[model samples]
Target: MSHTPTRLRVVRAAAALTAGAALFVGGPAGVALAAPPAVVAAATDHSLHLEGAPNARDVGGYETVDGKTVRTNTVFRTDALDKLTPADLAKLEGWNVKVVDDLRTVYERALQPDKLPAGATSNWYDVLGQAPITTALDLQSAYVAFIDAPGASEAFASVLRDIRETDGTVLYHCSAGKDRTGWTTAVLLTILGVDRATVNADYMLTNEYVDDSGSSISGSLMGGGVKQEWLDTSFATAEAKYGSFDNYVHQGLGLTDNDIAALKAKLLV
Candidate 1:
């Protein structure tokens, strides 16, 4: 059926966004965060779901502390869209996403080039999954690494920067949109001071996006993978390296104070 408010509420009640971040490798020293309530709600509210793209969703209608809302049909995160059904293709076309930013590395892109929606401006940006942020780097290790990296935040900020400078619906995603997509959206919302638990909750929604085998799809885009440890590790790394989600978005993304103010003006009401 549809994603529930209870699934989203778990994030705000018990998930301590910062406490479990210390345990990036998955131990008792850190907190266990969940997906943000707003992100999950957005996926539900907009009815942006696709029959083929499991995680494809728009980041719209989220409330700001100032009582503003994030614009709808602006941002979406999902997997490679090289295999969309005609009906699903029509749905994305209806959304009119103009800029499709492919976050996959060159190698991944070559493996499965996106079948971008007609008329969408396709761009590329590498999320650097292979390049470890630290010497003891391990791919698919735990949520800790995923939570603690600056690179993902930086990449995510670039997308935000482009949104203001240009106009169009921008859709972005990596191989699965789990590690990179999760981190990027988490940082963006956190910059708006949404909440820590909510951020984690948003990150965890990958489970819902995927299937029993982990890797799943919505429309043409896919999410999750068999035994993918990087999802958690990537997040943990961001937390350990950057201090907090907001810090990662501001400092790691290199978003200047003016840039942030502009983002606030553009996003918040």
Candidate 2:
């Protein structure tokens, strides 16, 4: 998951330019400015506000296409929990989190394993374990691989199954919670009928929550701020391969209509 510093810089610079252009175009007179993605996400913030895991938040409060809202305190998404403070652990306990799903690689787990709250069990699903380690710096390709890589669908399906079947709150995370975890969030939200624009806004909220300056090169590459296109690539890949997101969930991940129905019943309120 490592990339040359030169490539990283190039990719980051391109992202910066794209962001700058957005700002510039929106700043022109009479061109009404749209709300930033973070602003939109604030309607459903439900953040855990953990000092160690700033990106941790509830995956709820989003209105579905049919007008129901996803329930809060049922499921959470987060960055690595290896650095949680005692107070953070208390917060998790208060939230009644019963299962913690880890989406990191085996090497990542060994480097910094999660510190679970009392009574919470951990489940590991290495999203990239079955594929050769990729050295490419393209975030889009990395996202597509999350869907196409061997064993990836199984791992993702397992996490969803855990969320669907677990009795209490479940918190799932990767090292930095933006790449693998972001895709997981997107898939879940889409399945629950959240619109594309809102899902993209939810994905972009990582830039406001995660500070990756101190991260390792791999972390920087994986958790670095996301772009709309990178997430779009994942959705496009899923559609191209499986015909639709529902098909991707059913065929790609091998979930049944009953399984998806169960997930919606549990997640939506």
Candidate 3:
């Protein structure tokens, strides 16, 4: 049922719920729930989890301004699932996901690929190319990125529009779920009216996941630019380009009125 608790209870309950699900520590939702205490004490701390998929987390239990919470299981974020462990596959199987909207480019998906739940629809919505985001890539680049990336807002909006009419969960992702993934996620959260700092914090979480191995998401401002300062500049760039996070939703991503409304309805409630 929808979370209809009274105002006082709503805030209190949401605070408690946020503590339980720490994704909101970044933005609207991004943190992966830490394993149980017993699991942490085990020799192999994450044996019960998927190692190939870094930073995977459920976007559940964030308290909205109103009393309700974002339902668990409807949304997820992670590095590409192309490298799922067998156990990871089974974990997804348990989530009853109906769609895996992969945001990687055609080349990336063909090269690395994602692991969808058995019988789940593997819808490829390329929101952008696999290239790093920079002035080096133009509007054509953005459109191509939109086309090649997963969770294309225009396309995902279509998916959201239809999914709302149906009854199963949907998950979308890219390699880092940062640029393309970040844009898609930022848009969804923006519709929910989440603050900018929280949204940018969520975007910055990519730095925590992949080893970087010198391969980068956005291009270097200069050589050796993988330093933390450069990453900060990147978020600063997003802020400058979009004016505000919400503007990125309406302007950069071009999420339509109907699309924004549908996402807020599904995610916020």
- What are the per-model C-alpha RMSD values against the true structure? 10.2, 12.8, 12.3
Candidate 1 per-residue lDDT, tens place, 1-269, comes to: 22222212222211001112231210012222221223333324432567766667655556655555665555677756766678777777776667887766555675567877777888776555433434123334323533433344455666777655445567877766665666667667766665555555666666555564543322112333323334445545666788864565556677766666665555544
lDDT of 1: 0.54
TM match of model 1 to true structure: 0.69
Highest lDDT scorer: 2
Q: Point out the higher-scoring one by TM-score: 1 or 2.
A: 2
Rate residue 140 of model 1 by lDDT: 49
* lDDT tens readout by residue for model 2, 1-269: 11011110111211100112222100012212111111122254456778889888778868888887776777789988989999899888877789999887666776677899999999988786565444133556567888898878998899998888887788999877888888999999988789987787778877777654745443333355667788888899999999998789889999887777777777766
Q: Name the runs in model 2 displaced over 4 angstroms.
A: 1-42, 218-222
Instruction: State in Å the error of residue 76, model 2.
Output: 0.5
Question: Would you give me the overall lDDT of model 2?
Answer: 0.72
- Score each candidate by Cα lDDT: 0.54, 0.72, 0.48
Tens digits of per-residue lDDT, candidate 3, 107-193, equal 556556677767678777655433344422332234233433334446645444534443456677766555455555555554566
